[model samples]
Target: MENIIKVKNLTFEYTSDEHTHRAIDDFNLNINEGEFVAIIGHNGSGKSTLSKNLNAILIPTQGDIVIDGMNTKEEKYLWDIRQTAGMVFQNPDNQIVATIVEEDVAFGCENLGVEPLEIRERVDSALKNVGMYELRERPPHLLSGGQKQRVAIAGIIAMRPKCIIFDEATAMLDPSGRQEVMNTIKRLNKEYNITVLMITHFMEEAVEADRVIVMEKGKKILEGKPREVFSHIDELKKIGLDVPYMTELSQLLNKDGIKIRTDILTVDEMVGELCQLK
Candidate 1:
């Protein structure tokens, strides 16, 4: 697969009248096409900062970020870089701009100067992709949190970005709402072949990712498949992060001499392991 995102020695700083605080420190990463990657970290760990840099919303104070062959540092590639890597922030309300759902979905395409007919087609397809076609005529403000987030996602889909960076996109939602968005996100990656870079705090959400990345104090401390990364329960805990429920349970069982696999990441896997022992 092609490398859709590449970050080399990325360092970003937030400067104020008093002093400058570094948010990302010499961070490096690469995301291939159609990969579902999750980034998990504590509040001040720089995951959101990395997402912003990937989308070119925040330029790197040092080093470089290249998205789909376009360098984010180059002013000429700014719009192209953003189009290649769209962002969906934490709040759905902040992203919604139009009164109606379909109109909101059409906004991105319209800004890109898409023709009327093509824009209509993209809007319909994008809405259907997020399971929001039936509610396309409804007012966005009237929809539930999940529905609104799906509309926000449809807006990005209509623009047809190769990669989407979700910066704590499900943070404000209830459990049901988070599941709805997660389902849509997985479908977009598996069915539509869009690359996903999800910055989230939920360990359960990270379990669905193809790979998991753990960051701390502006640096990546861990990177592996879900099972591999979550297996280091102590390391994650020390960093103020939690492992998936099943992984933690499996670790506890192993500590009690029950001898279950320490790397189990899901409920089904845990159940199967216990059944095998019986």
Candidate 2:
């Protein structure tokens, strides 16, 4: 698979009133095409900052970010880079630009100068992709939180980005809303073959990803398949991060001498492990 995103020794800082704060410190990463990668971190850990840099919302103070072969630092590639990697922020309301759902979904395509017919096709397809086609004619403000977020996602997909960076996209939702967005995210990666870079605080959401990246104080401390990374329960806990519930429960069980598998990440895996003990 092609490397869609590459960050090399990237450093980013915010300067205010002559005081500089390093938000990302020599961070490096690579995400493959069609891969679903989740970034988890405590507040001020620089996950969101990294996402912005990847999308070229902020340039690197040092190092480079290459997205789909386009370097984000190059001024000429700014628009193309953004088109290649669209962003969906935490609040759906902030992303919705049109009054009606379908119009909002079509907004990105229109801005990209897609023809009228193609824009219509892309908007409808994007809405259907996020399971929001049935409500396309409704006012966005009337929809539930989950539906609104899906509309926001639809807008990004309509632009046909190769990769989507979701910056705490599900943070404002209830459990059901989060699940709705998660289902849409999985479908986007698995069926549509779109790469996903999700920065989220929810451990369950991270567990669903192909890989989990743990960050702390502007640096990546851990990166692996979800099971491999979450297996370090103590290390994650020390960093103010939580593993999937099943992984944590299994660890406790092993401590109590029950001898269950420590790598369990889901309910089904835990159930299977316990059944073997009987």
Candidate 3:
């Protein structure tokens, strides 16, 4: 699998007159094309800082960040890098530029100088992709939280980015909105072959990812398949991270001497494990 994004010894620091604060320290990661990776960490864990560096929103203080072979540090490749790795931030309102839903979705391609006809087609497709086609003509401000976030996603996909980095995109959404965005993200990866790097606090969301990376104090502390990483209940708790709900329940079951799998991530998995005991 080709590497869509690669970070080597990436370090980012905020320097001030009094003190310098390191937000990212010696981070290394490679996300392959079409892979869905979820990054989980508490506040001040450097996940958001890492996402910004991926698209050149911030330059690395001490290392390299390559997106689809283009170095983010290069001024000439800034646009190319952004087009290759689009970002959806935590707030949808901040991302939406146009008044109407369809226009907001087409805003990216418009800025890219895509042909009028092509932009129209891309707008339609992007809206449909995120399940917001019917609301294309509606005012963005009139939409719900989830609807607005979907529009934000639609704008990114309209540019036809190879990879999308979601920086806590679901944080401001309600449960239904989060589910809507998550479903769209999954479909984009599984059906459209677009790579997804989602930085989120939701353990259940991380469970669906191909791999989960845990960050702590500006460093990569753990990385593995979701089941493998989340199974370390004590270690994750030490860092103020929670495992998936089912994993937590399984831990309690095992603590009481019930022979159940601690790696259980979903309700179905737990039900199947318990059924075997019957």
Q: Where does candidate 2 stray beyond 4 Å?
A: none
Clash counts for all predictions: 0, 0, 0
Prediction 1 TM-score vs. true = 0.98
Residue pairs with backbone overlap in model 1: none
Q: What Cα-based lDDT does every candidate model obtain? A: 0.95, 0.94, 0.95
Task: For candidate 2, write residues 28-62 as lDDT tens digits.
Answer: 99999999999999999999999999999999999
Per-residue lDDT of 63-98 in model 1, one digit per residue for the tens?
999999989989999888878899999999999999
List the candidate 1 regions with Cα displacement exceeding 4 Å: none
Model 3 RMSD in angstroms: 0.9
**Model 3 — which ten-residue stretch has the worst lDDT?**
99-108
TM-score of each: 0.98, 0.98, 0.98
